[model samples]
Target: MDPVRTGGLRVVRAAVVLCVRAAPGTVALSFVMMFVGGVTPVGLAWSTKLLLDGITAGDPAGRNAGVAGLVVLGVLTALLSHVRRYCDQELSRRVKVRTQIELFTAVSAYQGLAEIEDSAFHDRLRIARDASEFAPVQIMSSLLTLASSVITLAGFGYTLLRASPWLAGLVLLSALPTLRAQIRLARRHGEMIVRASPFWRRQAFYAALLLDPRAAKEIRLFGLAGNLRTRMAREIHAGQAEERAQDRETLRVDLGLAAMTSVLSGAALAYLAARIAAGHGTAGDLVVLIAALAATQTALTSAVLDVATTGELITTFGHYIDLTSRARPQPRPVAELAALTGEIAFHDVWFRYAPGQEWVLRGLDLVIPRGRSVALVGENGAGKSTIVKLLCGFYAPVRGRITWDGVDLADIEPLELRRRIRATFQDFMTYELSAADNIEVGDIGGGRGRADLAAAADWAGIGETLAGLPRGYDTLLSRTFSDSAGDGGHEPTPGVVLSGGQWQRLALARAVLRTSADLLILDEPSSGLDVRAEHEIHRRLSELRRGRTSLLISHRLNTVRDADTIVVLRDGVVAERGDHAALMAAGGVYAGLFRLQAAGFADETVPR
Candidate 1:
């Protein structure tokens, strides 16, 4: 089998297994109901003939029994149909939830944290995210319907054979092309969908802008609603057009097939009716044959539809196969990493974001002494943040290994290294969670429970902030789910929002939630704060660094003038390294930027 087809088959089979596993009893119930329901359909067709024969002859003994049998068959079929629907519901619900849980967990485990900047990975993530919803379960249900429909068609054909073998054969032949046409349509539909992936997401983003509180404010301020909607409609139209074109071809093919099936069915009915009129068959037999053939056509059409639909859905999941196959996390050996200390040394380290990209850090050598505060100042895109990521173990060096107290960093376990360190990046996230949960998110292990979050927040300067919230730290940070509608729609209630500086403070607090870490990294920790807040945070940072080593990356030269050591980075290499005064005498990259910043406040204070 071709790879894509094989993958699609595998996905469908896996979904089927999940459906079966979710509610075994329901699966059994569904099978039983379908079998019984099919039997009742056949019985009803036969009973109708018998009832008609007795009525025509006016024989009360046979008439009563035939009428009662017809009624019983009708009631049985209705009850069986109900049971089948209930079972299908149960199976669908369970499979949907379980597939979502697994897909969610799989995406969570997707590796290559360092490759997060890769756009290709983002596209793959998109598929995995869509897969995490209810698609898997829907495909499974479609497949089960296909199977039951096939069984029903077989029963209908068997009943027809008892009346006229030639009629049954002709009906089967006429209906066969319907399945082929549906299969072609499914492939075309799936292809159109995959091609429209980017368009769909873009439409969704523009659509999202109409509803989001923050985006809504700016959009209305700019009077962009009409423009945004107009753009959205264009993309939507393009996608719809692609779909219509695909269906237009299928429509033609299906119409021809449907016409053929109808002609054959009509011809069969006429032939059977003529035979009954010619005294070759009784009226009762004629009615039974007619009903059976009609039911047979319905069952065959249903079977064909289910097969194509389930196949198409399974094909859609193939989009995720490449990403999911390689998404497994890298193994980490922890026992050897437990001996790590804060001493970090980068030796002849070379790095690149991608294979063909320029090296961000080339042949770099640096070190941070244990229990000391140090700063790295560099121009934008000059590999300042890259170094921090390397130290934090988000990425391993392309050429050299980072050492932790002398052991090669790569040899140490990633989890162990991460547990022993924390960092607050310049572009830190402002989580839409409670102020308490926000800070506690820094050290999830310790961030949970009451005492730990409080201690971390108190140390990071979030105590007063939380106390001021409407519901204190328990309040949700989003307005969407906060004021939920009683009927499961939008509640439209707003939640407490925070200032930029306040949010930055909370991010910092979250980062240092685990004070026991051997190393702590602060990258532009005071970026958005006012002078007083900045000074206060610096004071807190200095206090927090006691007995713990730290690396501070900042462009604000004034903040780290008193650092134990200041290194200047330029053009992917360290340009100058020394104490602030020594760097000033050298007048290198760090000194120049520092002096320029000092010139802004020259009259207030001067670095000696």
Candidate 2:
């Protein structure tokens, strides 16, 4: 089989499965209704012919029965039409919900962060997610529509053949040109949509920026609103121009097909009228022939259109399959990791984000001993955060190994390894959730209790501030959502937004909630705090660090002065090692940086 055809079949099969699994009863009923509706037109046409013949024969009883049958078929078709519409809508809703859940689950299953960071992956993900929302429903609807059209076409074609085989054949052949045109148009439209996806994504990004409260200050201060809006409009116009070209071509083809169809139908009707005038066929025969010819044209047109639409839908659905089928990172060994009782050492590790990129960590060797505070100090781009990412198992070393108690980290599952450590990043997220939910996410399994949540908040020095809120622990930490106090009323309360310093404290509280984690890592934990607030938070952190293995990364020399060990990194290599006093005595890079910072606060006397 051709690869494209095989892939399309797979997508169709998957869509069928989704529909059946989502709502089997509704799907079954929809098919039955479609069949009834499809065969009803033939029955109505024959009944009308019988009624006309019976009236001409002067048989009053037979004419009344035919009239009653026509009325019943008309009512039945109307009822089936309404019922089928309802079933289609309900089935679409169910399938959309199920497919979206499955797509997101596949995305979250990826353990490596590299794929998520890639721009190409984001584009594919956008296509996959959008396809999942509508493709399944479209495929099923097209299939049902096709089935109905096929039944109607076969029934009408048989009736037309009984009248005149040559006329039936001509009508069928006339539909070919329209079908061909529609198929070509559909292919062109699908290609255009794929080519324009990136532009659409950029337009969405700029539109989001305009609505984001966080960007409002910078956008106004820098006068960037006009520039951003203009860029967004440019992308929209570019996409629209391509679409308009395709639409113009489609309109031209369709108009040509319509003219051909009209000429063929007019010629066929004239021939049938002459046959009736020659007295070879009755008036009843003329009525039946006209009805069958019109019905056949309508049914064949719909079937062809359904085929074209389904082809486009399947093409879009290919993205969903490609994203879900992407190879995941290599699996780690199933062996259990031992407790972190010994030192965690990186043995001559080398790593880079991509193959051609400059090395972020080159032949780096370091040891973080158990039950001791290790401070990593360096300027920007010193591989400080890279080390944290490796330790957390977000990436593996390209050369050498990182070991916990002589056991290589590669031997343990990333999910399992992360369970024993907790860390806060320099760019920690400010989740738009309730205050309690924010902290609970840090230690999801342990922090469900109110007391545990409060204790963690207190340790980060944000407990008092949280208690002062209207809803305390339940207060929403963002202005994005309406807060409902659940007072059994319809009104919603306004949510509270936190300051940068307070959000930093909440992030710290989240990490502190993980009391069971063997290793605690803090990166720039005090960067957002004022001098007095930083001092208080550090005091609490120092008390909590006793007998715990912790890694602290900060540029402030004073904060790491009390650490058990201080390591300075430079250009992807460790440049200095020892406590603050020892490094100061050696007058190395760390010493120079510390002196430069201390000079900022030194008293200077100017002689006039």
Alpha-carbon lDDT, every model: 0.76, 0.86
Pairs of residues at least 3 apart in sequence or in different chains that clash in candidate 2: none
Model 1 Cα lDDT, one tens digit per residue, 86-132: 77677767866775666556666643364466554555456545753
TM-score of each: 0.90, 0.94
Shift in Å, residue 343, candidate 2: 2.9
Residue range 503-534, candidate 2, lDDT tens digits: 99999999988777889999999999999999
After superposing candidate 1, which stretches have Cα over 4 Å from the reference? 1-6, 57-61, 114-132, 222-226, 320-326, 406-413, 447-449, 483-494, 603-608
lDDT for model 2 = 0.86
Model 2 TM-score (2 dp): 0.94
Which pairs, if any, clash in model 1? Answer: 483-491
lDDT of 2 at 416: 79
**Per-residue lDDT for 69 in model 1?**
88
What local lDDT does model 1 show for residue 560? 79
The stretch of ten residues in a row with the least summed lDDT in candidate 1 is: 483-492
